[model samples]
Target: MPLSTLNKEQLSAATAPIGNNLIIASAGTGKTSTIVGRIAHLLQTGIEPSKILLLTFTNKAAGEMLERVGRYFPAVVVNKIESGTFHAVSYRWLKQINKNVTLKQPTELKTLFRSIYEKRQFKRLNHDVEAFSSTYLYEQYNLYQNASLDGFDIWFIDKYPDHKPLIDIYMNIIDEYEDTKDRFGFVSFNDLLIKMRQSLLENRREMQEVLVDEYQDTNTLQSALIDSIQSNSLFCVGDYDQSIYAFNGANIQNIATFGKRYNDATVFTLSKNYRSTASILSLANRVIERNERIYPKKLEVTRVSKNYPPKLLIYKELFDQYQAIARNIKNSYTPSNDIAVIFRNNASADGVEASLRELGINCKRKGGNSFFEAKEVKFLLDVLSLIVNPKDMMAFIHIFEYGKGIGTAVAKEMFECFIHFGEGHLFTGMLSPRVFNLPKLNPTKNMQLGLFDDDTQIGSISRFAHLKLSEQIKSNPILKHPKLTDDGLIFFKNFYDFLKSIKNVKQPQTMIIKLINTPLYEGIVEMLSNQRAKLKSGEIDPDKK
Candidate 1:
């Protein structure tokens, strides 16, 4: 905890005059350590802990900082330092004042976009528009909002005149999305910063200092939010060379222009390498020096030099390269060696994995395949859950949608009914006499009916059970005798029979196999087969497989 223990540059940075300071912290340098020391120095200098804010780019980094502060300082210092990601801190601040804001998750946003697209009958492009909307459009929207631009559509059309038709369509989607969110009183992840900045401008909070980590990775909105919140006292630490998040709207110029933007900002460079040898540092410096617009800082290695240059291997083909790699691992590595073969993409590892297996080298993949995401595994689990607890609406919905007549809309309605009532409510509601006798409305007045027919009321259970109920209504003489279309006797009988058949099936594998052999699974298999055929015929990229 002593300030004297830090390197001269670190100690100076930790205890520097705290008026708009930027620390260019290189990789392998003690950036986090410097930030923690700075916080400790501030606390030791009689600064109110609550008036100091520490922001990171991730929850994990924030947590790590908190943990380190706790380890190095007293509990009082740890408790008073407000620390979190930018979005988290902004959201917490807004929530404290009772803002009626809802944060849309990525999945929720994608679903909303898909729903709007389907309803509007938009012409489909070959590219994944949902993905494009999320990544490119989302970033551009935030940038536009940050810059206070009101006419992004016109700007985009003017910029890309050749693609104006598609751009116009996209602009409509964005307009519809904005209108929808406004009507529902919803806010997105980026809206948190926009609103936070607005609130701060109206009524600035009493914060004496703001320290941001990974400043180079901040987007324009985040940078604006930081500027709004910090009252001439800012300490940002990041390396411009390490900025690689431009795809997500990270503006490297934020770091590059810090001094110019904050005219009185003091800048410091921390370029001492502590983790790597001199040879490695030299090689890295040589490679990065080629960049035309780099911050001029040379890393001085403090560790003992390995004295050996890095080795490079070349082969004629991917399989040959993988084979050589496998041979090298088999000959040079032991079971205890902590080695990794990193690849740019998961598909690139196929040849390496095969080669490694041929050489009998055991390796494990880092990520893939959560048990719940596997189709066969999830189906069986859903069935088991339904059998054990019939009131499990999620499980019931999944199983129900597998039937012939049940689609997502019908299943959602069933789920809603189940939520309002108790177990087996969906079945009872579907079979109710009230639903069967409901009068239909005009088509124009029944836009809310969704995929159902215009004559079908919202609660018309028989219409939902079209194929499933019609088959039973004709095939079973007993069901026909009940005149029970009004009572939903036929639908109830069919549902109960289906549930009962799967209830006592003790062997999950057998149940899974049986389910796979059904029409639903056959359809899925055929779709997959057609996709593979397309890939084989060069209509689709094999790498996408």
Candidate 2:
């Protein structure tokens, strides 16, 4: 904690707060600690915690900042201090201050196309109708629509004014969203900053000092919010070179433009790598050097790890790349250790997963949607619906057997059985019913079957199921009852708590699955495998076996 122990650059960056401050931290450069130290120093110098508005890009980051501050200086901080992701903090602002704030309806691109078709505005294009019916279409529509507005928010829209008709429609929807949210007490993630900025714009006296973390990741709305709340001081720290979220509206140029925008601004750079080995820092520096708009900062490492020159294998083909990576892992990787494979797209990881599985390498994709999108998750959601209302049995089964292509006749018969009997019976009699409608077949009588007992491991269903159940228990206020000790509930609560405790700061799923590894979770894995095998090996005996 001594000034002498600190690197010269860190010391210099921390002390120099003349105007606007920007700290460019290279990978493994102790970025969080430096940020925390800066905040601590300000607090030590008699800057009241309430006056400081610290913003992060994620809830996890906010949580971490709070935790760090609590550890460093607890009593000085207020209980409900303003700090969170830009979206979260903004949302809170809207809720607390904006009485008339409203959220827009989240419509997919397909929905927009359908609206266009219904309104007779769009004839089917020669291109693939399916492609037209995508989330991209909606994004494009939003871009087109929001591009024509007069204000800075609509600068993009105004630049492309030819899309005025679409812009008018989209703007109306955005306005309606605000109105509807105000009418029915609903606020969106983005509306937080919008409403707060509006509040300050309408009533400027309420503005206060602001401090934003990861300034490189600030979007237009967030920067605008900071601009609106520009009073005491604007302190932001980030490295534009580490800006990886350009796809998600993050504007790295904002960091570059901070001085020009804010006439009274100071820029500082932190260039000491404290987290990684010297070799790793060298590689990271080399990789990011290619990126333009990079601040002039050199990351020099003091600690040198024994491991040097982190492997960078490049293969000829995509499959070869995957196989080579997997093979390398097979040779050197250990189980239960963190090994990240970063990708620009989800599609790129699919082949890696496939190739890794082929090599019998037990690897999991770290960050992308895992547990939520699994087949088992769909199955559990279906089951939950069926349990809540037995009439939704067909719907449940359709979701459960989604990829298998269940026929209408088979679906109807299943529905009929569910109406007559119950989910427990239908589950027990899965093999007995002629779901495929061949000759009368009753496979359930032959296979040992019984009601889904409370003791059976439910987590063993699927990653999706496990994730859904975990999320449900975590989010649902009603289900947190102390008396609920049923076997399924016990399994769910235990896994949920475990997953919650091992919360991911960056790669969320990495921590989630790491938390989910237990006997109960293993059972869920087995159940999913058995279900797949049942269909593949003619063991279920329902359709044709």
lDDT of 2 by residue, 285-376 (tens): 78877877445777777785686677766768887887777787778745625666666677888987887788787766667556856755
lDDT of 1 by residue, 78-138 (tens): 8887889999998999898656666765544544444343332233333333223334555
**Most lDDT-accurate candidate:** 1
The top-ranked prediction according to TM-score is 1
TM-score of each: 0.71, 0.60
Global local distance difference test of model 2: 0.54
C-alpha RMSD between model 2 and the true structure: 15.9
C-alpha RMSD (angstroms) for model 1: 7.8
Residue 524 lDDT in candidate 1: 44
